[model samples]
Target: MTENSEANSPGWFDKPANINRLIVALVSACLVLLAVEAIFGKSFYDDHHPAHFPIEQMFGYQALIGFLAFVVVVFLGTILRTVIRRSEDYYDR
Candidate 1:
């Protein structure tokens, strides 16, 4: 290797990689979003929170509602999944 070649050459990794900048940008974006939510009082946690009852008092209601929601979701998923299962190897003679 000549002096001109070494002088003109990019040492190992001289070019900037995009991934580090992208990861930093994503982390900054999430922090900004959290900061905005903290300032504006808007949060998914607050939105999905259950009713205004104490921990001990609402256990039964929470359990009942949760069980109902679970049943409904499971029923819906079962119906949807059965639609795909109905076409099992029917075309093979």
Candidate 2:
């Protein structure tokens, strides 16, 4: 991997500044969406769009549930990994 070839490579996010820019862009997008929801969510929900469950009417409920689901999936994946992991000497026998 010579310096010139590395510079010509196409890994845009390999640089620290690019990663930071990506993070900033994503966070800004989320904040903009959150602001839009905060300003419009109640009216949008109330305009003949009834929730299936009573709890769904609460603010930030969907975000909370999504985060909880993500946490549960990660936790289960960790446990599953430990249970199914192969020993280092698995093929040496």
Candidate 3:
């Protein structure tokens, strides 16, 4: 790669500092959202249909559920990939 080509490249997130900034921003946003929920979740949301199960009312329950759901989906996707994957030159014939 020539200097001209490298200079022309527009890789905004290719730098480690940018990646770290993005990570920090995302984590900070998550923490802020959790704090908001902790402060007003019961008064704002639970008034409609209060959860009977004690575990459902715990802090971060929704986040836990969402994370677990994502993990389950990725796990299923890996299993599906194993079932559908083909040999590298499958279409060369």
Best by TM-score: 2
Clashes of each: 0, 0, 0
Candidate 1 overall lDDT versus native: 0.55
Candidate 2's TM-score: 0.68
Per-residue lDDT of 6-80 in model 2, one digit per residue for the tens?
344587747989668666876787678677768887675764766778787777776778779999999999999
Candidate 1 local Cα displacement, residue 81, angstroms:
19
TM-score, cand. 1 vs. native: 0.29
Deviation from native of the Cα of residue 71 in model 3, angstroms: 1.5
Task: Please report how far candidate 3 places residue 63 from its true position, in Å.
Answer: 1.4
With a 3 Å backbone cut-off (N, CA, C), the pairs that clash in candidate 2 are: none
The CA root-mean-square deviation of candidate 1, after full C-alpha superposition on the true structure, stands at 15.9
Q: For residues 1-93, could you state the per-residue lDDT of candidate 3 as single tens digits?
A: 122232334785578786686678778877998999888866745567777788777888888998899999999999999999999998996
Per-candidate TM-scores read: 0.29, 0.68, 0.67
lDDT of 3 at 12: 57
What's the lDDT for residue 88 in model 3? Answer: 90
